[model samples]
Target: MGKIEIVEGDITREKVDVIVNAANSSLLGGGGVDGAIHRAAGPELLAECRDLRSSTLPDGLPPGDAIATGAYEIKKVKWIVHTVGPNRHAGQTDPQDLARCFSNSLHLARSLSARSIAIPAIGAGVYGWDHETVADLAIRAALAEQRERGGIDRIRFVLFSKDAAAIWSQAKLTHLGR
Candidate 1:
């Protein structure tokens, strides 16, 4: 089984095989983690998102679904898996939708033959999801995917704040009874 870990740092800096972006449906980049990732991954990432928008994902990506794009200049990562998390403020508060963000990202990573993935706490920031709630959903969903696929060896919950990281860390410990 893959191990899930939490870290307090910039997700863009992680040396994982893939980094999951908390992207908006447009996949064109927005504030929070999305914008930070776009900025770090550079313009090539934006161009790929534009291509996705222009072609395969013409109407933009939907919430809960995930897509992969080249990481471009972002060091140490091969791909960026973008998943649009449900926006609770917009009445898209279904836990299943939130869970899909994790599961689908993992699915994409497994498809990409990724050994490790770094993910942000999707929807827990400006999207209005409580940190603890997101942590629990992410943990459960990721574990389920790992069990089913058994391809990824590491899943990292990367947070920008120490408080958020601590919340995820504790949630994992509690969920796994460690």
Candidate 2:
């Protein structure tokens, strides 16, 4: 295992073994992080997603579930892990479901033997969960998973905005004390 790290910046610019896409259950591109990931990864990414939807994932999977695809334009990673986060409804996020997204992503990365992975604050965007809370959940899940599996070298929380970036930066200090 490698030293745990917390970085503040745009996910698209981060160099890691893989980056996660907070996709909709349909596995097709939706708004917020989902849309941005698809757009950044390029049209081929959308095409591959559509091809997967047409065959591999016809009816769509449940939230907190994830799938893998080839990294399109993102230079650093060889693969992209796409996971559907629980939509914010009725008030707070479902803790178990939200955590599943993080855990499941780590599981996929571990299975792929990835040395490092980058993730965004799941459910923090249009889902409207508090950034600090979501980042804590993400950090906790990744650290826990890595502790058990023993392969993941690093986890990066890539933030799209400065406010969200600050939330993760503070999260690192509060939770990891680093």
Best by TM-score: 1
TM-score of 2: 0.88
lDDT (CA) per prediction: 0.91, 0.81
Error of 1 at 104 (Å): 0.3
Which candidate number would show the highest lDDT if scored against the true structure? 1
lDDT of 2 by residue, 50-78 (tens): 89989989988677888899888877777
Q: What TM-score, over all chains together, does every model reach?
A: 0.96, 0.88
Ten-residue stretch with the least lDDT total in model 2: 1-10
Model 1 segments beyond 4 Å from truth? none
